[model samples]
Target: MHAGTTVELLCRLETEPTPDGGRAVVVVEVSDHHPARAVRARQASSADETRGHGLQLVGAVAESWGITYRRDLKTVWFRLLAGPHDRVYGPPARFSQDDPDLQRDLRAAELLAPAPVRRSPARRSDADWINHGALSFLAEASDLLSGQLDEEQVALLAAQLVVPRLADWCAVWLYDGGSRDSSGAPPRLARVWHSSEGRIDALRMALEKDPPVLPVPGPQRDGAGAAVPWPWPQEPSGYGPGGAALACRLLAGGRDQGALLIGRAGLMRFPDEVVGLIEDLTRRVARAVATARAYRNQERISQVLQRRLLPRGPATVPGLESSVVYEPREGAWAGGDFWDLFDAGDGRWCFALGDVCGSGPEAAAVTGLARPVLRLLARDGYGVGEVLDRLNKTMAREATDSVAAVAAAVAAAGPGPDAAVELRAEAEQTRFLSLLYGEIVPHADGTAGARCTLASAGHPLPLVLGAGGGVRVAAAPQMLLGVVEDTSYESESFDLAPGETLLCVTDGVTERRCGHRLFDDDDGLAGHLTACTGLGATAVAEHIRRAVHAFAATPPDDDLALLVLQATERR
Candidate 1:
């Protein structure tokens, strides 16, 4: 059935009802089948093996089956008796050798015996060996790739995994993303290695001295080839030639990220199966490399952008110590969370921690605008409430204009498939921010040595860790900014004696999740803060960061920013 379905034989099926059940029979006849040898039969080599087991299966499932042949035709037949009353031949003893009927039946059965079958070696398909080896290799490769995100490590792993397994020598080269050469110039060689550890140095030197052999554009444009033939021309003492080579294109996201070159010396030529296995390996490697590159690039850019948005260092103030920690979510392109500290002169220091409502470049733009504007207005002598009021008005105005612009663009684009999506997003136009801003004014107090004022705009209340290891939220009244024009905010004043600490963090800290439970406001953040009351500003900030991260089962889903301020001396 697996081979084909065309046949020249005739088949007949008959059935008859019985008192207990039913009886059925099937007969297949082949007439003058040119070569009688084609009709020979043999028992299956094993019970589990399917070849030559068709009659055996019928005999077991259907009560009886036999073959009879004539000079002009061969008829094969099978019968089934569904009733329990009938007992057919039970054992070999039941058919005595002395009986004439038994002898006649034995003679007839001998005519159906199969002639000697000429056994031939089974042909292996290209996928058989590849699937067996590739399954294990890919599993190991996946584990290796997951353990590291650096492209260099991935390339090194690829080279090492292929050597001694798929090749005697292997080398991996990656494109120099930062190369300043013209596009036509060859890609810079990033890695080169051979199977023998002792011969690695010599092989590397030869590779370095020779110009890179870029693959010619073949049927596949991305690139696939061995630049130089094996058997080192310069240093052939340790290794000899005649080794067949393979070049696999490292393609990721439809682009050629790199190439893997492998060589086998002597008689170990790459079969089609091995070549297919290498191709699959290269495909996985390319995807991993591409992902690693993209992640690294994003991290670099995120660091730069975040640094520019936040102050390089904490605000310097007399009798105060401050520390901050900011960690962006892994793989996130934009950091909506931001914090800043800058001295506003005259013994007053302004600091703020805020989170934009969204992420990506759009949220980054809003953050850039908000952080600097807050600092500028505070330095210009605006009170905490007044600064937020003005900032909210500015955000509201800009958001309105942005919506109008997007709407116009959508209308101009016409009613295409993408246009409706754009229109919907623009129509929603929800851009807002949760902020906690405050001005710390140094003053003397009898019980509390130093005093400061804090304010909020729909932000989490600050946690004040007392000198004696007490943690409680400092309450304040507020509304989220950028949602409405002319929004007003209320301030709360709290005094911190020496050794007391003020811990303020974005929602990314308290909202972190562990399974179904959240590191919530009442118990989670406050509980961690109580344990670090006497710690210095930097230690307290780091403690909170560690605690929140430990509580989350997975990596933080949003940006985390924390600001810690400690009263070191009396005003």
Candidate 2:
């Protein structure tokens, strides 16, 4: 989409033997960075009809057409019955606008295109009305499918998208291995939809006994735009008019994602245009299925790592109450942010709240190494500053190892096309950390109050809430960890007077934005805490969490976490 961007282009034409003349299938593929979506047909204003005629034009002339997507490539293909072989396709001897045949073809193209091609107001029905508005159906289908992240939801939506419109009933069968040919498992019937609600179960049960086995798209196989005839079920009365039934493979990312089946009771055979439309819908469904599967796999890993990183509950302090609120922003789990609270023995309790500079598996690796090392140092009797100083060294060492490993990988990639891209991607991921680490010691009475020692390293300063509703900063900020080695850190020491509260929050809370205004604009966090002076630690945590969410109409875009420590007398 930008100047100097390199994209591979490919074109292939294949001929298929047919009872009626020959058939030609043309496939065009191009490299793409973004996921595939339905072709968009924008509303036109003036008489000029060529402006936004993207895939709409293809939909007009092609007898059957569909789209397929791989990880880095997208293929849009169309099929048409071959004409007389002797017909010459050379350049016209003299081009003229007055040609009658040319004029006829132009009219046909216009008439075949969806209603928006001929009229400005083809918005005859609501977008959800299937098959009536072709443009709206495609645009809405893409919007709905592209946003789904569950495989089952994708299957359900596919079945509902076709039934009661193009067909009397539709059913979806998904391969657990994403390959119907897999030796491990068989295709599973995921969803079934029908115009009559009661027929859904009967249809599903009948279909389960006979799963369709379609050929994988290949040189010998028919084009992806084509569907094979499937047997009609007549076991139950009224199941079919014996009209027509067809099934197509849901193929994407170079494998069969699933199969789609649909049947109409009255039609002897579906029109080519209708078949092409269903083919396009199948591709979109396949792409959505692939995306949902990828996300589900990642979610499984993220939740597992997140559980290991965060504690179930903060350790109990003798004279102080502690509560924590942690929420990784939607889809940003696995090292976006982490917090820990544990007892280090010797009447000392250790607490930490931190954010990684990057995200994903790389950041998870850093956080994974950081959390356990923090516990090890605290248990070894390292004071607050001492623990941070040692952890910084360990993080620096790990960062060096990571950089070296990536450099080695780049070298192994050589000067090939992927080398530079790999290096740039690796360079953008950092191991630096912003952290708030502290030690808590209850007073000798074990209920009067506690002594607090804490340090902020390139992190938001902690706030101390006084008994009389006043607030102030607790620790001064310093350099971030994993960036520089042997950095001497300083900890602020203070008495946690009875009934006072300490609030330490990650940047997710302080930097929450609503337009140009931030949640912590003009000391807003302190102001919010000022109102929460007399509440318990849990209440203060909940109050602050709610305030963060209420600060903006949208949810926070970054991982949010906070720690609340309240000093109490033996309660």
Candidate 3:
């Protein structure tokens, strides 16, 4: 026998708890290289100290000993009774196939062995011994599970990783609920496959014909790391080990993602060592599957909420052309920046863009509230200044109510030393918005022209780009809305030439930081607008977005919103 033979024999050792201590079985498959043979230990000579002592010790301790071969696989098994019971049984006996009691024990031992694999006849180097190399198999499993982000993909990869390497067939079941382990719920079958397509189809047919081996009835252990006995045949119909399958739960962190079932043809049973290796492999698989599931869930939720908060598209406006481009900050569903264009009245249109104080759901909530309120106030024929004033008052009242709610909730829970501090912070959590609100009235002239009245509320002044390439700040910056109730705002009027454009933007564009310098202050945006003098509204908006992205050292740290309006030539 070669060195790999000893390793293979060790890998095939399995133990089961008997009524006494236990029964340890070692299975050595009969193959072309090794034929069926009988062995007799040489009698220890008077001078011989250790040559045959190995078998003598085995015979002395074992209450029973036997060898059995089924389906071309031979198993060598021995049973040792617990304590005083062993003394009553005497020494181990020779192998026997005709003894009814011994025959039944051997049959049961064969079923407990790991599923057998059909090894290739080709000779390989010591480094490659097929399934016998447990360490190498684990390394391969680790490499296969890395970098997979989808739970289903991870499960599929796990099934593929074990086949033709560890087992002939593999099935991965995963818990579908939030709980970590199977203590609360049963795992659902997630993926299954076989080394050969024929076997896969046969297994599928068999599964359809019979009930799956449900989880066995036993005391559910929280962290037991071994293969559970699943009462499923290793192969379909008259093939493989009959009704012998092993399953180990896959666990990572405190959660149990599910279990892995491994099966193969014939009477080959998995050893305790092999089961331990499988348990470790499943741990890695569980963590990867969990992470992938979490990320996908978050992404789906974010996409849904963001779609609701943003406008369907820029609202249609006649004679006046408009376009908007919004990019959220990384790692958030929605950012604070918002913009909309809506019909205010006969021959009048309202377009406003604003940014709330922060990012995420809190800011999104304020954005959600501010946009419609601005629309309602403007449609009711409120002037730009009056709109900002009313918005400030409304936000202030909302903030006061929120602070009161926080204080009450905290008080009900019983105040601690930090309670007063927490209350002060909540009270100081006043929500605010910076806005540029404008109303455009088109000229009755046959030529495409418009009169735009706009007010600035703690927002960047709108940029008026002339057809002649001159960039001018259109209105003086004023107090931002949602800060002080009585704060006043002023309006300014400007004419849009047939080819001129007005650009409204959130602070994400102006405050874009490269090192310590701002994008707008360094003439980055101004220079880009000058070069895009003759472009239409949509083209100019896209050009600015590209320019900002290219100029930034990193992705924009804030949300970006750009709204462009241009007076077009008559068609």
Candidate 4:
């Protein structure tokens, strides 16, 4: 009865006449194509946990059940008899242990176990434990399953949760994209667990040889009737001697992710209640699987986008030690902060650090456009100031087109008057940028220091740290890029003497928050750079980076980027 097993049910009610009163008999028969676990029990009760749970519940209440079988159908039947002499007046009091029905239930328990050990005294009252511990177990299972973002890890957790609680052994099979018939990909065994850990591998090998397959249009396709009896594994011997097992499809959001197969070492047939519990677990597992896959896919796409937007890394700037730190905030596909250092023609090296106004694909678009144009202009011998002027004109033109596009899309949706304001705000967000651009020329003799020319466009001013710990601003701030095409930019020039460092950063560092205080609230970054007078470029960058992180108990929400350029001694 693995997965696609067919089942049928029939009911019969009869009344027998007596001298004083009549007795009524109600019988139900459940038939299936294969031999079932409910029929093998000679006597069933609460202690007979291996005997099917449905039969145990029926046996607890019914006065007597008659065996009804035919050659054509494999079936089991339960009969309930009520005579006029028994409780003919009022309903039996409370359903506690003092009731007659419960007293009879105690006798049924005795039939299964002369000495029954109970997890709860209330459960010992009748066959109620069939539904007992189920809620608490599912809650714990959900807690364990939540926040899991790896499919294989979800499978492992599912197996561990079920073993010893719901089954003696458990196995999880995962499909790559869809089930075999749908995706043409066979399911892979993701995890196998057993109460006794030693038997897992052998049982897994056995199960793999003949894993249960649920194809299209089966009962597994729908949510109801998710669990079906599965044959016990025959591999490595002794598994099938006196055990029962089943496979339940793991489905969520109308997608089939995998299957959960569970086996009990000493059960006749899996109790229907237990099957229901496993079915619920399968649903939760499927959801966890879907969630994990979604997270992985987003991470992958972010990676691909990042590669397309940024270079492999910055290049070496000769005669000067250069170090950079870039940390994108977590859970973001792309960050606003970006930096590049590359060789320009004629002993000139070009470097720029810029921050887009926003994040994700929008920021990615601007980043993709800016870097190549900057590199092309610098290599063609454009000075830092001239490059900014030309890049600003280009950015302004792109911004106008972007705003027009957004307006068209928004207008096409036929929204109300507020749409105009929304369009303006969104248009303002694209292409607007804060940037610091610089060019360097070594002393014409490959010495320790170089002449630095730089400008800032509404960006944090660069700090110059001398070997003696004095800090000075390297450049003054100007209008931001992409804001106006008619604006002119100015550049500042200075000699980077040996052992002097130029520090540049995006807002992420200057605005890092600790309580109400910012990292650079009152020239704090300058003060920190003053403390690293003797450190190398990398050391200075890392020290300032660590200090910024330690300033706040909470991790920085904004993307962080810093570039350190120190004039070094010739090797």
Candidate 5:
């Protein structure tokens, strides 16, 4: 029988015995004896004839055959090779040491063993490339400013750094701040140069469809075209061509600025390393754009505030043509020089010039408060002395630490020829202003005479320029305002010829410098003023304005205010 048939027969007779006059019996064993031994054993059996067929079947299935003799009985045995299901049988106890075929088969099985696992070549190489590219791109992108990288440059870098490095096409899209679509929404689209023409057309068509389809997760590719999901949900779609792609949202300060899309043409799509690089680059771009926008906004706001706080037109009075100039200090502080002309009623004009002690928003706030208060007091018919007293009272009541030096002058223009007499009497009683209060009134035959009642409060003296270019500083100076509530001011009278000029300025002018040299103390500013005396009050004011600016070579360190008043007589 064939080995397979014989094995089946032996399985059926596993518990049965041969057809002999003896007890039914089956014996199983293991050995290295060849098939010839089984045949020889059968010939020697006394019951050979009766069990011949069974013996042949057993010999074919058995791994070896044998017999054992005892004192009273004999036993026959057959060895069976273990089958796949025969777990009950243990391994063979012994095999022929000289059996060459058995040794050869065992060695062959050992030689066919499987190898140990390792990383794929593609994976390792790609990792190395990604590391090197990320470092290089970071170094280069960090140096690019918003001003330097326009939209086109940004798109190009996206492709060069991400597309080829990741073996994909790249695209970026920006949200439009203006120009909405048919839905009354702003237009958002892929930036030019980043999207192919066909993909761009598709995007336009998709946007036109009703209830536009938003980006969804996973590989969204129609052939080579793919649209990556952007962080800015409102931004228009950016499309590229590839099998797999990744989309990253560009954000700055918690705001969605734009999106970056990278596509891969092959199975080797963007892994974690590539995605990380794209994210880093996108973050940098967002930061640069945000910084630029913030800077622009700050500049615009500063410009508007400066124009609003500074003076505009010249002050107009009948006999007095006044011009004023104000310069703010440099650094973080806003300058606080303020000047104004208020109609004090009864044919009189009240003018005051003052400077707050410090700079910046706080000083500017004080200035804003002071200008209107002075106007209100002057309009209420308060004399120069009373105005100073009220101003000091307000400051003290408010507990304001800010101090100021102010000079005010009030003059009646339409009184009779004895107006000079009336002004001198009023000046003697006016004692509060650390100021020079002056009045110009008609004399006999309608000629004008000027009476200047002066006081000081740690402030600079006023400068007077005569009609024929004569110059004289105020002969007396007194204490500043706000220091003494009951201090007495002095009165002095001077003749005002036609075409005379009076100049009142704050310390900003005299205290300025020309590249390290003082302009006023060294006589530089005085000489410039004298040489330019032919100019009218407005012109003189402008000349001084230019001189001070040129001297400082920058914005003034304190607020500078100049008021030039030139007398114009009726021809």
Candidate 6:
């Protein structure tokens, strides 16, 4: 027999009776043996004669051939061993068709068999595989719990863990509260999460069907028309093997915020080990959502408070057109940029813009306190210089750890159609307002004049936008506000031609960063102002604000307060 062939043979001996020339067995013992087995048995006198080329062919192909002897007859059998390209046949002897347990075991073994080596490294140990899977699941869960994972992240995680692991497809859908119905109103079908994109689309198409998903709150239902419930089915249709789902309500401050849905396909029910991990992750996600909501609420409150404290309307003086713009810092922090234009009575206006050095509730508090105090000082007839002195003292005394700076101006309007001329003379006498203060007044002939009073208490210089498109630095400044009680400030006056414009701004306006250069110290701000000449005070202020933001490539780190004063040709 050939090396790979299995064979069996049976032979029998018989005595003949002469009735019809037929032979009959008579107590014969049969012996069977074979080195080679014939593939086919044909009409021949004996087994030896039948072993022609057929047996040679069998011997060449068979791995091994064998035979045994029996009492009455002999039987033969042969099996061909599989080759490199040939497939092995037959179930093993240990295989039992009726035993499901055995089938499951075999299936698992097949599933876990070593795959062909590719780019991926081999498993270091069984523990390593378990640890890697567990850690990955935990990381995803932690991100969800921490609010670090967004909707996209959650969706990706679900696909990674459930799709191939459970051998099924999955998708997640969120209720879109902003969606409107056919009547241009919000419809009920807006809430639903599914593992199948097709299913999500179907639910959206049938939004009016009053499906199972419900809207987060109110009387409306989700796009799927389903009620919001805890542990909602991960799968929309509840069928399939290894298939299971879980839904959990998102809550913040004891109110339903949203919901999370997770699912896997097939008969595999979620084991306690997996379910517990999912539950923990859901809790973290819920907590993060709550925190985000709270942060938004606080931001809204801060914006409202800041708006209320700052001036909403421009200051109107007889000979002067003035506009002030205040922009808060970005992010969650409440800024300290504060500006107020108070009617000081009798054709007079008192304006002050200041920035506290920090952010958040503390900065807001300082702003809140400083606004009222500055108003009171103006009411008490305190000069701009004295107001700064008192403000510095109050801040220093009240908040020792806080550092702040302010630039302020106080102008008294003169009476009659020649008020501009009268105000110009008054501006010339403006001595104590500090070097940082700028005053604009009209001469008797209706020509405009400006005096820049600057104090370099470590503060930035102001830029002047000339009416004829001339950009130049304003009068030299002195020390900043609140540094010393007895510091002296200087003022210089200059003539403002027919269409000249003057800009008085806090450092926040010019202190923006452009790549590696600081705008406050460079000529970029002056260049922008020069380009924006001939614009109205309001327009000029807005242009400067936009330019500064562009230069910084982001929101300014400090609060920005701008004051634009333009002199029209009196046309």
Q: How many clashing pairs per prediction, in order?
A: 0, 2, 12, 0, 8, 59
List model 1 lDDT by residue over 1-571, tens digit each: 2123232566676666679755665555433333123334444344234343343344334433334433433344555433433667575465566888765533322432331121112222336635645676677667656555688877876876676556667777677662211134455456665644456666666655643444445445443322333333355543446467776656654455666777776644567767767777787787778767666755565456566776678868667889999887887766788888888876688989998877654566567777777888888998888899988987777754544453444332222213343434623443588899988876633333456777888887898898899887776747888887966876778777788898888889878888788887458788888889679999999988989888856889988889998888644
Give a tens-digit lDDT track for model 3, residues 79-165.
443344345676677777787777553332233232222122222322343344556556655654665567787888787666634
- lDDT per residue for candidate 5 within 117-169, as digits (tens), equals 21122133556766645575576556533433244444444444443345434
* Best-first order by lDDT: 2, 4, 3, 1, 5, 6
Off by over 4 Å in 4: 1-127, 130-132, 177-183, 218-225, 235-240, 265-268, 307-313, 329-336, 357-369, 389-432, 443-449, 479-490, 553-555, 568-571
Q: What is the C-alpha lDDT of each candidate?
A: 0.66, 0.75, 0.67, 0.75, 0.50, 0.48
- Number of backbone clashes in candidate 2: 2
lDDT of 4 by residue, 1-571 (tens): 3224577888887786778767787777777664322334244334333433343444445544323323334455656664545556777656776777765544434443422232223123212444545776677667657757788888987986776556778889988754444466778888988755446667777878876676545555565427888876766352434488888877765557788888886678887788778888888888888677656655564466578766677778777899999999866777778899988979899889999887754566677678788899999888889999998998888855654553444342222223453445654677888899999898887767999999999899999999999999999989999998888999999999999999999999999998899999889999899889899999999999999999988888999999999998877
RMSD of each: 18.3, 14.9, 17.8, 15.2, 34.6, 26.6
Residue-level lDDT of model 6, residues 272-391, one tens digit each, is 555555455545554554454444445555666566566658666545567787776665456666666666543345655555555554456566667787778767765555666676
**Top lDDT model:** 2
Error of 6 at 352 (Å): 2.8
Pairs of residues at least 3 apart in sequence or in different chains that clash in candidate 1:
none
Best by TM-score: 2
Q: In terms of TM-score, which candidate is stronger, 4 or 6? A: 4
Q: What is the lDDT, from 0 to 100, of the residue 318 in candidate 3? A: 72
Candidate 4 structure lDDT = 0.75
Give the least accurate 10-residue stretch of model 3, judged by summed lDDT: 114-123
How far off is residue 449 in model 2, in Å? Answer: 2.7
Worst 10 residues of 5 by lDDT: 405-414
Give candidate 4's error at residue 417 in angstroms.
34
State the displacement of the C-alpha of residue 29, model 2, in Å, after optimal TM-score superposition.
38
